[model samples]
Target: MSVRSLSATLALSAALVGVGVPTASARPATYELSGDAGGSKFEGIGYDARTQRYYVSETTGGEIHRGQLRSAAATEWLPGDGTDGRWTARGVTVDSRGRVYVAGGPNGIDHPGAPDLWVYDRDGRLLAALRTGVPNAFLNDLVIGPDGAAYVTNSNAPQVFRVAQEHGRWTIRTWADATATIATQTGFNLGGIVLSPDRRALVVPQGNVGKLWRFALSTGTVSAVDTGAADLVNADGLVQDGHRLWVVRNFSRVLTTLQLSSDGRTARLASATPTDPDRVLTTAKLAQGRLLLVDSKFDEPTAVPPYQVITMTPPRR
Candidate 1:
């Protein structure tokens, strides 16, 4: 239970007895921000509190773009020299020192030995190079948690892993293992993972099966973060502002948030963006008090490229 030796616990995924979740409805307004990036598949998004800027990474193009996140219309943050314009970027993270880290993989295929995690300054200057050799670790989304450790998600392996800055190389640890083989399900890929404000729990959404899982940092055990969805809802990105767990249901097309219990298990739906039937994959990012979401435009075979990033300033009632 004490994660000092990296000899973490190996407990089987629990909550197998609960087969179904009761249906419920949530209320959140859909606000669309005006901007387009040519249908790029936006993988990871983060907001800088220091500069008040929003960063979204392009999965396919390797473009880590900057954008102004405001109540009004927003524009894309074009790449820079030796910064954005010069390098291919994937999962991105802005550290406490204001350093930005991006993940680099060979476009789509397995480019082994290729450093996937890249670092940049606030001005987009390449700072550090990081690579992890976790089997099938196709880096997707990256986030610097409240404790300052960088956590990443891999789509292919469908596992949530972490990296620590030790000596110079980014020492890696297999922090989260949400393998689908344990669940007897096909699509349990952990897409986005984030820690709660208390640093006791991690809220993660699966892209294939549309489920949210809450794992305890102390116990290293996982439970159903959200049990409501029973189909291909495609839960993707996640972020937590201390208390509530905000998740983007990619296939269901809704932004939902729920409160985490003090014990770090069981996630109940608290709020959800209002959507009409047939709407889909509502991706989201939470920064400060603002929630940024995008209405994915589906162009299958090609997929949803540069999914539109929309901003909504929720009225605090």
Candidate 2:
């Protein structure tokens, strides 16, 4: 769809969906990302609440974009095209220490010398570019754990990699392997992930099977989360506030809300709201009481410019 048609369709959908839309006075509604000549497509987004800065990753190349909460345009923070041995980037999350962690999706699968993930300090200096040592690892999305480490999801396999600095040295290891519990599928096996409100477990969605799995942080045991009757197919990025969870179904263009049990074992579907029909929002981060969603443009046959990270009010339960 053309840009004009897409905006009009989104405006109409917002009115019909009955959700609170962001007015221009409140925010710009959408934050633009710097584009590349290759028709840069984006995926994961990370927000630094402390600095009011947000980071976005370009999928076509390993470039990372940075924008501020008050700014309308993001500038390129990191260059792609094999810079730092990174050819492509995926999920991104910022640690409490202002460090940025980026997932290299399928970058290491074909090239053994390529990095599977990268870590950068607050100044955008490369700290580490290491591989998980897992074969065919498709590092998709990641979330910062309570222990001040990054837990990344492997889309090609049922595994989670823990990337952290140990004894002044950076290391990447397979922290949890759920091959027996969660079966690997054709498409993305695991996509979006979030920590439970209690901070006891990691809640992840298996997009191919439309299932939720809780990975216990203490024991590393994986169990299925009972999300009764919620069609969570294509579930991508996850955002959690207390027991409330928002699941962004990318291709389906649906934002699903669920109330989780205190222990994070079960969930009740609250609502399934339709998103803009023209964009595929891959992931989101909650910042300043609003959601900054990445409009991935993965659905477009040929993506256009003015790529954006749109803002929306949290859906009411």
Candidate 3:
């Protein structure tokens, strides 16, 4: 292998070593991404377990970066030419077949196009750009269901967009529209989302209320997940592992862990751990037992080398 490829392989091997091991005994470590020092506005994160590579999406620049675990060097893997000045990249998820689906916006009043779901191949080639016809659609985070359907959340509107293959072509439309009780948003509603263990429902947190909600897949029903006295408060990116929920509170700089009841209607606080407080972390992905986070720092002036992904062991509940 070439020198650069060899280095990446070594780093990935080290990262994979901790995948199956329990995080309760693992120590936290931070790996800085080195390459493309431009203003990326990195926000969303996704991990491809098959290749042991993590994908980070840019919010404003519309670029996708690929890096190995435990490595400081990351290459500019996908430069979505259309994303540069017009569309913006938000959340991203990679399917079992290595197909990458990216979320974008109904932003730039002058841009004049609905939000879209951009799909790409493993090589970063643009495969399809599926648009959500919803007006002012701020397509935020997304999750791929067991049946190969994509469920994406819209922070601006009280709805979820679903993309599926029909007649050999992809189609996008509103899957669920939240009713009055659960579709609340102070600034950004429904930031991060994940599917339930059984893949029958989606668990999401309201950014404004800091409360969690469950949306049934079989039925277009929405209900709040009782947290008793605790609130996810500012919940952003979320990942579900069995009965445990891992959430990122961006503004608070903390990762909150919760244990869900058997029926998936209630949750209770397990633990909350501190992350890099100075930087704003938007989303997280689980690689084996390790959790990887991307630093968006959206409002801050762009840094020289920009920010890096923070990898650590999830706090014990």
Q: Between candidates 1 and 3, which one is better according to lDDT?
A: 3
lDDT of 2 by residue, 91-193 (tens): 9999999999999999998568789999999898999999887889999999999999899999999998899999999999999999999988899989888
In the range 64-110, model 3's lDDT, one tens digit per residue, is 88887646556767775475332568888999889888888544332
Supply candidate 3's per-residue lDDT for 82.
70
lDDT of 1 by residue, 178-261 (tens): 574325246536667777666776766666766666667766677775445333256676756656666667666555666655
Better of 2 and 3 by TM-score: 2
The total number of steric clashes, by the backbone 3 Å criterion, in model 2 comes to: 0
TM-score of every candidate relative to the true structure: 0.70, 0.96, 0.86
lDDT of 3: 0.74
The top-ranked prediction according to TM-score is 2
Model 1 Cα shift for residue 88 (angstroms): 6.7
> Could you tell me the TM-score of candidate 1?
0.70
Which of the two, 1 or 3, has more TM-score? Answer: 3
> Which candidate has the top score in lDDT?
2
> How much is 11 displaced in model 2, in angstroms?
4.2
lDDT of each: 0.55, 0.89, 0.74
- Which pairs of residues collide in model 2? none
For model 2, the run of ten residues with the poorest summed lDDT:
18-27
Runs of candidate 2 exceeding 4 Å displacement: 1-17
